[model samples]
Target chain A: MVTLGHFLLFSGLLMAVGLYGVLTRRNLIAVLMSVEILLNAAALAFASAAAFREPHLFAGQIFALFIIVVAAAELSIGFAILLNVYRTHGAVTDDAISEMRG
Target chain B: MSLTAFYALAAFTLVFAVFAVTTANMVRAAFSLAITFFLIAGLYLLLGSPALAAIQFMVNASAIPIMTLFIIMMTRSRSSGAPRTWQIAAGLLAAAAALVFFKGAVGHHDGQINPVSPELLGSNLLQAALLPFEVASVLLLLAMVGAIALARRRSG
Candidate 1:
């Protein structure tokens, strides 16, 4: 009974929430968290599409697995960047670290 | 019953995701994010992708949150002030626009819902996507090195 529309709607809402968070939050870590949410939304969409469209190939699930690994790598690097920024700037707010202002 | 369970899990994931994003407390937000991850994993299981669900549970639910917490501890940067009214308005507008866009873009799919088995996934990975899988591993290794290099204290 749960159709692709249901999954798409859920992921759409989640992606919207993540976009709002990314735009509004000043903290870099929070923005990173929002990015994670967005990635999860993408993964959900892929899985649902695979389930409905090409259920035999399992390509969508494999892609989702790759997405998870990439997200993990991205988080590690992002946290490292946060730590470095905190060490140098003494603050983590996106507005506070504006050294590269053109 | 299955449909009901799916709806419940989806609602739980979305609610906690909102909490993760909107809450000002950093630690609480991280925990909320973890809860969302777990709920999404459950949803994946309900969708008949147990391999993906287990990976989601292990990596997103447990490992990623722990890393985030460690970073939070190291930085000790917990001051999250309220956004300006204009920023909030812009964010809301963007969110609304995104919702409309996605809703219009994704069409309803009426094809057969064939659940992918773990064996199929493994064979596909090993046969069709083997190179990409190895490349992803290499990318992970590079990321590990890059993180270590970036976080290392400079020798004065």
Candidate 2:
């Protein structure tokens, strides 16, 4: 049986991997990539729960859809910002982009 | 149970995620992220939410990651690598916490779920959440505009 446990485990692993990337990556784009992973993990967990709960678990699915949409939007803006930073600085290092680091 | 198929798909998703995240190349990472998202969309299919699968495919797989890839292309970024050590360590620790939290939330044991789903699964997902959906759409538009604005060079 494809149990809920399996989904949870896989999603958990995905989340961890994403977390590792988000923490470790110096590139703004890479960090954004990690955020994508994290969001997908959340969607997996939610969808699996919905599958087990009731026939009308559309709420969870819809919410996940929303999250994905928002994620796309967030990434677009984030990339733009990164590009801008790159234009001015010629570099997009995570640490170096900070102006408020004082 | 479809244990083999289920395990196979989830494994595919997991492995791709690892490749996507760990790969040093930024463009490769973007591609990996897209693959992971696609496989996760398959997971949504298994979970009886084809609406979610479609949305995942359309948005995450299509519109979003491609945008990232295009941005990378536009920038021609020679840069590679993520943050430094402490940041990576912090992410790992937090991800570990998330795993723990998820495990607890799902309970101690795996439930026997019926993977054979109905045809009209979450078909109305978009209809019901129309308002929030529209708001999200607007946010996406704003984000696109903001990205372009950021990318633009100001004239002297």
Candidate 3:
């Protein structure tokens, strides 16, 4: 039988994979993709918790829904920012934009 | 709950996610991401919430990847190149840290798993989470407008 611990551990591994991508990826768009992975891992954790633990309120599922909404909003905004960055720098790599580096 | 099915789904999901992040080709990575999310929706169904699974399949598995592909096309970024050696080290360290943090945060909880029906979730949304639902709508509108304004060309 699969336990809640199993689900949580799976989510953690997913998060670790996403974190690695976010930390190492050079392209800003790849970074955005990693961020989406992170968000999905979080939503998975929420849904699993709601299924296994929170029986009465089922708050975890609702939280997952909101997380999805926020992720969509965040992606649009982040992509727009990336578009502007590309227009200005002519490349989407993180090294291309270093004007703020002090 | 079927343990074998869960294991199979989890393994596929992780493999696709790893490919999504590690692949040099941008289009392949995006497609891998879409596949990973679609598999995650299957996991959601196993977790007993079909509504969330359906939404995940539609919004995350479909719409997000299409948008990502569009961005990739518009920017003309085909390959992201390779990470530097130091970046690989940093990524390994970060992954280790994240694993440790999440492992510590997860408490042992063995209980009766119940399937959440759509009606119950819907009723709770309108009754308990009504405020958040409204706020999310406004937030989506804001994001749509903001994206359009920000991406628009400046005219003299």
Instruction: Quantify all predictions' global Cα lDDT against the true fold.
Output: 0.88, 0.74, 0.92
The TM-score that candidate 3 achieves is 0.97
Colliding pairs, model 3 = none
Question: For residues B51-138, could you state the per-residue lDDT of candidate 1 as single tens digits?
Answer: 8999999999999999988887788966466777988999899899989988754568553577777888889899988999999999
Q: Write the per-residue lDDT of candidate 2 for residues B1-156, one digit (tens) a residue.
A: 567877888888888888877777888778878888888877777776566777788888887777888877877763566456777678778878977877765553555443423344433644666678678778878887887777778998
Off by over 4 Å in 3: B104-111
By descending lDDT, how would the candidates be arranged? Answer: 3, 1, 2
Candidate whose DockQ is highest: 3
Docking class of 1: medium
Error of 3 at B109 (Å): 5.0
Candidate 2: CAPRI quality band: medium
- Model 1, residue B63: distance off in Å is 0.5
TM-score of each: 0.96, 0.86, 0.97
Least accurate stretch of 10 residues (summed lDDT) in model 2 chain B? B114-123
Question: Residue A58 in candidate 1 has what lDDT?
Answer: 77
DockQ of 2: 0.64
Q: Pick the candidate with the highest lDDT.
A: 3
Per-model RMSD to reference? 1.5, 2.8, 1.3
Report the lDDT tens digits of candidate 3 across residue range B1-156. 378889999999999999999999999999999999999999998898999999999999999999999999999999997999999999999999889888854566664578999999999999999999999999999999999999998997
